[model samples]
Target: MTGNLTTIGFDADDTLWHNERFFRVTQDRFAELLQDHTPVELDRTALDHKLLAAEKRNLGRYGYGVKGFTLSMVETAIEVTDQQVPASVIQELIVAGQMMLSYPIELLPHAQKAVEQLAASHRVVLVTKGDLLDQERKLAQSGLGDLFDAVEIVSEKTPETYHEIFTRHGEGPERAMMVGNSMRSDVVPLITAGGWGTYVPHGLVWEVEYAEAPKDSPRYNAIEDLGQLPALITRIEDGL
Candidate 1:
């Protein structure tokens, strides 16, 4: 009952491993430096809201890399604080942004185990988005690349992107599944394509998107963590 999936696409960042925590740590340092200027707090939650808004506003030009995303947050910081934030601030954040991929890659508990188990009978693929060099390096460093049949670090996930994968694989909507934490990039698009999507909610979700999703959103099937993927996959494979 569990092996019906031919190809399962997994989101790299938050799904298969720990990702947002790195960003959160970096932003904490950034916030510390900005404390004196504005009475407004520069904490991670506020900063994430800013970055999420910036990402949506400048999706085309700036894209989703940490540099642009962090820089946009810096720009917002300067504007919101209504004071002169140093020009060096962005550079500092850029240095911090590099830490996302610079630090040793740490997979969530059972991440590699889960992937390895599935790869035994199904085609497991990595579908992630981020800086090309950073992402590739992290994959190689994690030593988990072999667990996947294919690795794709895409610019963003949308209907077109899923179409490319499913169409090329000769996979119709019913046989493919995408597992990830983001409803915006991962869940919505996969569901739109008539393919199933599994949403694994992370502890520190960026408030920019999911904050807007009501608790009862029917956007996708949401799970508390990636640990549920095995059973969830089994259920979905049963056609209910």
Candidate 2:
């Protein structure tokens, strides 16, 4: 519900456009590359778990996005193969990451219409955390850049980051809401910071971004998709 939300902050990656799918595809390739290095063949499930662990371990060192993911893949390969992974596999991991950086943007269902509707009645901002250049490129390619009043590419999503964005843009957290896919990155932190958070579920979630749903919180809402956003916000505006 809109309530006092004069400003709406949207997360870029999976919230507005397809993102995790590409990462999954690249991950499959990574598993294949490491197949020979391992004593036995590694299935997708097992490989995925290892990669997720690697990503979490590397988060502090490399942060997020393609570069971090690429390095994580390399690290996972080495770890799973007992540090006997070949150089060619490492090179391929780098290439996969580069390919992801260059992949085309595919907007999610009703993403454009929802954003356009929200922008019509609120100060909408694109608040996403990732590689600056990659995020910018995707925004540009998605053709959704002009719909936002402001765009922020931050290193991480935290309560302080939300405060800086809201204050810098002349909107108090009480008058703002964050709409996104990740409960960890896009919803819980802001909701805990005196702002509202609307969660729009995506098909696949990154392990690092997963968290227990805070469904009981007054400031939190979980919606099926972006298409329902306008009607939901209208109900909020009506205080229903």
Candidate 1 residue pairs that clash: none
lDDT of 2 by residue, 1-240 (tens): 335678889999999999999998998898788877886666778888888888888888888899899988988888888889889889988999999999989999999999999889898999998888899999999999999999999999999999889877647787788999999999998887788899999989987898877788888888999999888778777788
Task: Please provide, for model 1 over 1-240, each residue's C-alpha lDDT reduced to its tens digit, 9 standing for 90 to 100.
Answer: 144567788888877777788777876776776666555555556655765677678767766667566666677667656757776765666677666657888887768877887777667788888778878887898889988878888888887898787666536545677888887777777677877677777777655436223234333577776667777777756666
RMSD of each: 3.5, 1.9
Q: What shift in Å separates residue 194 of candidate 1 from its native position after superposition? A: 1.0
**TM-score of every prediction relative to native:** 0.82, 0.94
Clashes of each: 0, 0
Where model 1 places Cα greater than 4 Å from the true spot, the runs are 1-4, 39-52, 77-83, 87-90, 211-220, 238-240
Clash-forming residue pairs, model 2: none
How many residue pairs of model 1 clash at the backbone? Answer: 0
